[model samples]
Target: MNKLEIHSPNSPILLTASLHVDEARKAIASLVSDLLTESQSRNEAGSVELVTLDQAINRILAEDLLSPIDVPAADNSAMDGFAFNGDCLSSKDDIVTLKVVGTAYAGKPYEGSIGKTECIKIMTGALMPNNCDTVIPQEFTESSDSSSVTFKQNQVKRGENQRLRGEDLQSGKAAISAGRLLRPSDLGLAASLGIATLKVHRKLKVAILSSGDELRPLGQALDAGGIYDSNRHSLTGLLNRLNLEIIDCGIVRDDPASLKSAFLEAASLADVLISSGGVSVGEADFTKQIMQELGDVGFWKIAMRPGRPMAFGVLKPADPKNPDRKSLFFGLPGNPVAVMVTFYQFVRSALLQLNGANQTEPPLIQAIAQTPIRKKPGRTEFQRAILERGPDGRPTVRLTGSQGAGILRSMSEANCFVILHHDQGNIAAGDWVDVALFDGLL
Candidate 1:
């Protein structure tokens, strides 16, 4: 058999690929580009809902929100003081005592206009009466009587302590662009612009699944050869944080027939399908077989140590049940640590592309290793480590323990992953290492 070939039938190797790490990634990215291109054609059928500003939190902007009117609406006072003609204040020491023509409060305009040597008492957010050019803060003026005040100093400049109309947003200008995800501050900005309703992109629908005969549900009796399904729960929580619509497909057997049914159902309803386990080289690894039957399995096997057999593909119906509808899928490995590493490296990128995210890669930083480490030279490695600030304030990191695929406790104890490049064989203490911060689980 060739290096890429995986012997079928009763062969020991379940699935193998000829491509190396970089080649595999490029191939997978190519497939993902196709899927993303096709996804663009799948028009969102969900109808829009006119929700109030309070209810529109975290939704995508469906259309560009333009300002119908300028923010501040008109020239207004920024503080509680007096509005006056700025030219009347001649010098720094010049103090002009003027009668208060009218009092103004926020949302209530002062009827009378200010003339030369005249002023109007105004409150915060209150509009300046016509012909007033500047506002003197109340702290700089002394109240001589209820209807008059004396300026203590005359150093204020024109438009000082005043909010000019359209300073923030001009009429017909775009206040918020289309496809922006709404946040608290965004909501407040929209509210300030008098926008009660906003059009936003529909929430992405994702289907999550976990497969293994040894898996058991929560609060269920664990018989022999059974383990609780932690991958499904972990993925569900992660997707929840992204604010996507999650369709839990629950647990399924490691059989080809069962996987086929689950894939069909997930493909029909969900925008993306994520499955854990049954993609390795085992005889019972039905996910690999089922993937070939259902659609095109683009790439499998990344030359990353912990996550080697990562799979990416688009599901197409073999039968006539919506043959044109292609559903994106990511087949993560069975080991918990492998699941996480592959998800972050591969699945996350795919999801971002599906969601129209602009940036696909996470941030990276460089740090020094605390101890010497040894490894084989074929694949890259992600060693779990705890990063710390040294006495000199420099960042340093130390690996927890054994860097095994099954050692999930090591990942839990470490705060970051010290990345070892593919060609690297070993490292000495105090050597520089590339560290990827564990921003969150996966």
Candidate 2:
């Protein structure tokens, strides 16, 4: 039998007194660890598909990248200079004259060896001929004849402008590790290693659903107590960047039977299911009941601002006829900002794990405040703000006027998020705070 990994804290499911932010994060982290491990192991038949360098962007590596050959392949000139023995250079007044033996251009190398006191005109990236030890810039060398050149008075030493073979990477060394999410720079690095193709993890298949009786499809006339569904389109945009295969399940009503049928249909086709709205304990909410009926629900009310209620669980078949399969399910709250934050904070890690990508640390910076802000201690808050360089050359953060949970416009215009910890609440002007840069978004 498979091990049961659902978490059950001794305290109530919902905290009465606000929890310390660190404690809350720790709890969530523990749950995420288990979730990720299970996800990784279940995907053990993990295979990598070979893709061309052009097609490898945003794909996760499925195997360790071993360098097949040494970089540079041989010592080369780093600048357009004269390649000669570096030990021949002495004091500034000691002008050393050497016979110019040949010229070396990029992609074409001289095959002959160099004699003592002989130099060669070499261009940048040109392979240094045999017996060459240093490169002196052409400007540093004064040529009396086309056949010979003399070093001018300068404080230069041996091997000053030579790029040694394998300086960047050695043969058989690890070029990139397994589970690395490919970035633009990573692609360049792999290309430098002569890797025209890479083995990458398969993209995740996800099913998306939106729930609410008051929600109507866009371009349709809205009935009383109804609103247009925006979560579906917003989530699709996010998933597009993640390289996920999305199956839009459309909108499910608040009725139990309809939700159950939608869940069944989605679970049959997707490895993961994401539901927005209808997870809270409101009277009209049917997602939570349907989720529990189909599988186990480990609901968490993380002590964090903007996003308080989030649900995670596995979705299985409710009827006995169809059984023995389950897919991961995440129920995000209905508020736009809440959904975005919770997905970034809680679900991003899980999704990366499922994709076989390793977790990377978020970028943080210290920015001085431009104005005073009021915040209570208890939960962590990510306030959107604009960052600008002050006269002192230090970055300063100015909060967007409103800190409301539904303010998506503020998030769009912000470049950074000021992280307000649970312990300290009151902040004064000019106080320094930790800012999480929105590098991923921008």
Candidate 3:
């Protein structure tokens, strides 16, 4: 396997005769790690702000939040039952009767303490009285009147159905840590701890654009050899799902001047500039030229199928006066499926890190291949596949029609990516392969 060389800003560019030349192909793991490291170095740590619990979902936590008070501030009942002293029950297997002193509803606790053979009718979430240690569910008792109840002895263990103070969360403990993406349950947890507002990192700003003379915007009439730009739409949707602020710069012509203008403008306004097409070694590919002139960019032939040509670096201001101002750049492939695959695999985690999120790569599960797959051993392959359960309840996967990079329908029809590792060759029907589900971002 060829190792990906990490080049400095002044490193010399390696040129090959063909775009598919196999020399110095970068491993996907190394490329992703480098990208993340670079992104972290450039990350500004985002601004902090206070947002109410209702508005905190999907926001990244900016600080470690220690709970000021314990959850369930007082000991409470976990079920609607009769709260009593368990020691009063007889050790023999016979009926144990108790006199109900009072009824304790939720939020309205019975103030008086219970004596031996005395109990209180408690509702769920009701605070337990001082002497009560166990609760017998109402269904287990045969109570004809509100005065007393009778149940079989040894029916419930001591301290059963009772919620202790600080059981869910203790005081002065970290309720939520920094860099955590707040979920609905997280909001509820915060609310339970009386945390009305939270400090969270500001949303990331991403500027996206597309390049190619043959590409036109949606709803525009296409001339000969021209196609609607689906990449921009797809990229926009993917970025929007991340809850980041997106600046769509639309399409730039393949001319050098037009490409240069777009890159400069994007760098000035956004934290990350993402462009599709124009990274390949075609005659009209001026994006590479302009990117290199403005900043330190590396064009790489990743050892992967579907998406091979990629560019990653930081774009600085072309003018020397603003040398410190820069934006991260990711140049993706032109094909629709390739763009999505590369973005999900490489760009997504980097952006999450930039957004102050605790980034974790999605795990790939082992699934049985339902059909024979022809593959080469040198390059990694990401084939669109439909995953389903087999007769034995094991996960099975099959390719989604054609595996062409340009085939957008393959991505639309598939639920996961059947990942063939770089060293793996061909696969039989029953072979176990790794698959990444599209449920997270898709």
Candidate 4:
């Protein structure tokens, strides 16, 4: 078995990538490199701000957080046990007995000294009394009275069942590194270290707009050929998962004037603009034309399934007051499934880079193929599938109904994408495949 590091922007995921890059690299890798280079050249300082811990969830840390004091400032009992000197365990007999001097509760330490052959009943998290270096769980004591307790000598070792001071985190040491997206546990850890505020990257403002004359908004009547615009809603949900600030420019008509207006408005207000539809070679696709007129952009047919026609580049604002505020543009496919696939492939990492996050892609898992799948060489395919653990505990996957790009229902029913790499052929029932689950990434 070998490990392969697949990178998108600054995020690198280690997976078993045996084949995809031999031919597919030229298109996807080239585009990724260009976007990453541009993202790195941007002024990172412009995206940093100091925020309180209450408002720092999902935000990227701009600097390492050092602990102000040691965690568990003093040694404490790890469980409800009897605390005593380790020397008590050195008895030459099968059992050691000690008199109960007093009790120690959490927060209130035992002030009296623990003498020889004397122990204190300590609760969990209670500070270890002086001269005590070991503890035997209360359950281990079989012979016990009101004043004394007896336990086997070999039941516990020296310094057992005790939490050492500064063992978890030392004072003046880095508790959390920069570029980490703060989670609930991280906020708790910061509170433990007395950190009231943290320096974090400001949330990236992402504008979403869907194009096409046949598209209509929700809760509205539609014509014979018109369909509800789901692409914008899907893009909005995907962006919300990253905790970015959303600027909804709504749906734009397919005409050149309407498309150009929407493009200009999005670029001026957002750090990134994600639009679905109108990147194809259709006559109504004035999106590409307007994007090129506004800034430098590229329209490429990616060698991938579901999402092939992709547009990526920078959209420079026409506003003279903020001419330097340019937005990275991603024009995704019109199909709902294609929009999601393309977003995960490209737009996700680009947004993470602009938001100052160090990692972008989610970890890839491997599962056994439960159903036979037909494939052609030359293009990578992301098939929606249901992933489950077999009776033997190994993961297995099967396709979720029809694998059509327009069928968004399959994407909703599936838990993961069974990624068949480029140059790969048919997959038998027992073949191993790479999986990207939607648990955290989606």
Candidate 5:
């Protein structure tokens, strides 16, 4: 039963005798890296456009951003205090008093030279006066009048509480490197360096579709044995989070002609074509046949629960006019929960790479399992679980009510995926397990 058998006369045997089911069950990390490499090979040098810093959020940097001027252009005060020469302090055990020469506010400077036994009332961000090298907070000293102040010995140190020019960033230094996706902090840093516009990579275009005769689009009345198409909506929402240009191809019926037309159109329109359903071993599944005729694709039963059946390859144009057109294709399982799990585990990172993002793998944290989990040793299991803080502030997890692949509520209710690794057996209560958090992307 490991390899799908085709017994129907009308269904062509797509699985070759040389196909190895065991070899097709790749580890998730290795498979993702291979997909990213393949995608990078197809992606040419990406084009770039100039955009203001306000519009650069989530965009990939096209080149190194060098600072044209120093951050904090001049030496300023780091606190609202008295600015004075450190040499004027007597000793750590005694108190010293000095005349308040003047007051320096932000955007204003005390132009006169600072003499011995003289200090200035300097506010935060005010320019440090000439010959002044230390700052003592106003609260740390006693001010008898507007012109005189007292400071306790050793209340402040030399060059302490002073902001030096170019301390954050120096002119001509790279502020941000290429390939970085701009965030809010990155935009603020660019603004500090006087960068008004930046060059960034264009957003990736993705085309998504679903296949099956038993599936109907939302707003359409369902016939007998038909289910409303929910995969497209879920896929579209996920793609939108990545900031991709989505080309939704809608639902394609389960027939050879309709599937072929959709595949060809999607290949021509998008850089990547994603399809859910019609990938498993079923007599009515015409998607496998049409996909085989169109391009190089491999059907696999990965050693993972919740999402096992998958298809990966490239689709090329059959028309002579668009002979050079090609698009990466990913065929996901039909079940509602399986579609989401497979996309998050495998396709998310690949799409990020294709979109010119220097993507990092999401972090996995260890948590104590509050209940026992049923699992075998040969397959990895991604059970949806609710992570909570125990009385001692340690992370604990409990499985969602149902673990079936068709139960979409399991994914909706859970905050994290409790990853049971391959070669791991049934879990006992209180056993530590690795979990990947949703982090609001759900």
Candidate 6:
């Protein structure tokens, strides 16, 4: 299936077509599946490249990474303790005294094994000696001289504090799987496995363009109807987080010629093209008209608040020689908050899949509502909210100042989105609600 593979432990998604029967709008999940299906059908998988461990962040793994050797290499001490044979363990009433043979540091091991009633003073991470199978922490042992150490017989169990070989990872085993989005922790793991270079997917090329005559670039004065082009800058930041190669195509006028030229140019240079504005119903239709001329496209009336109109399709380059060359297209609404909402809900996950990442869902947490929220039943609402600890130290969420589509400040002041589902209605104070956070607590 072309699903995004969302994972949830508690409540399952119950959104159905009957929720928006009056408007006949499509569901958000339906759109995501279609986009994924289109992406898979358009291209054979992207080629892989070899890169140093430091350069692999945010890149997708093309193959499984296997460990060449067992982790730890041998049995080792998990803490600073006295290592001795576990056969000496007895009743809690008995105290066992053993001769201290020698000391062992992290990288140094005792030359010879110890006999019964003998133990070695071992530091953390030091290899356990051949005759030792248990450890008694130094703090639990009574004061001991250079020759001997004393501890209660019931202090530790057999094999306690001894790290077994291959316990973390075995030799020739898959340490990291294919299609993983490499994080800093993943790099550390690869380094621990002695892997210096990784096979990863090449960077995806993305082109961003803004449409509308009223859109003004930086350093330009805005006229009565003109506004600064904030969407491009926001899109750039979002795409940068994924490490994609971004092309900033300046704003295009509403005319057919300009929109057509901009679309064709971006398609030629990028694997994916994202255009904001001019996609909604009754808006010139220049974007859709030009897109259809180049390739196939569809305009959707999604049943969601803040963002209702969306467009998705594939566009081919103007080049006659490479007729099969195409680029995936995402058309976002013009309203500032709507653009961000739709991007997070749809475009981000779709791009990750196209870049060869394993499909995964964004982290979500349920928080108690601090105040009443006015909402209708048919449409899904992505209401911006502030998530913080309440007086009792539990998470509590409250909506931002305004929930309008044009309120950019609402998105700015909020740290999360309180998702009121399609079939959901008004939320009262103290009611639990599902929240999608802006960033995870690392």
lDDT of 2 by residue, 159-262 (tens): 78999999988899888999997889999999887789999988888999998888899989988998888888878877776777899999998788888999
* 329-416: candidate 1 lDDT, tens digit per residue: 7878888878877776667666655565445566778888888988667788888899999788889999999878877788789899
Ranking by TM-score: 6, 2, 4, 3, 5, 1
Q: Which is the winner by lDDT between candidate 2 and candidate 4? A: 4
- Total clashes, candidate 4? 0
Report the lDDT tens digits of candidate 4 across residue range 156-233: 999999999999999998999888978889999999888999999889899999988899999989889999999888
Encode model 3's per-residue lDDT on 174-208: one tens digit a residue.
Answer: 99999998889989888877789999888878999
After superposition on all C-alphas, the RMSD of every candidate to the true structure, in Å, is 6.0, 3.3, 4.2, 5.8, 5.5, 5.3
Comparison by lDDT, 2 against 3, better one: 3
Better of 1 and 6 by TM-score: 6
* lDDT digits (tens) for residues 1-442 of candidate 5: 1112222112223433322223432332344455456555666555578999988887788889999998778889999999999887755557878888899999979988778789998999999987998999878885546888887776777889999999988899889988787888999999877789999888778899998878888888878998999999989988876777899999888778888999889888888889998877673245666776787566666678887778776677776865655677788999999998888877776776655566545689999999899999887888999999999999999999889999998988999999998789999999999999987344
TM-scores for every candidate against the unseen true structure: 0.74, 0.88, 0.86, 0.87, 0.85, 0.89
Model 5 weakest lDDT span, ten residues long: 1-10
Model-by-model lDDT, in order? 0.75, 0.76, 0.81, 0.81, 0.79, 0.80
lDDT of 2 at 321: 50
Give the better candidate number (2 or 6) by TM-score. Answer: 6
Better by lDDT, candidate 6 or 2: 6
Query: What's the true lDDT of residue 353 in model 6?
Result: 73
Candidate 1: worst 10 consecutive residues by lDDT? 1-10
Q: Against the correct fold, how does model 2 do in TM-score?
A: 0.88
Query: Can you list the residue pairs that collide in candidate 4?
Result: none
Query: What's the TM for model 1?
Result: 0.74
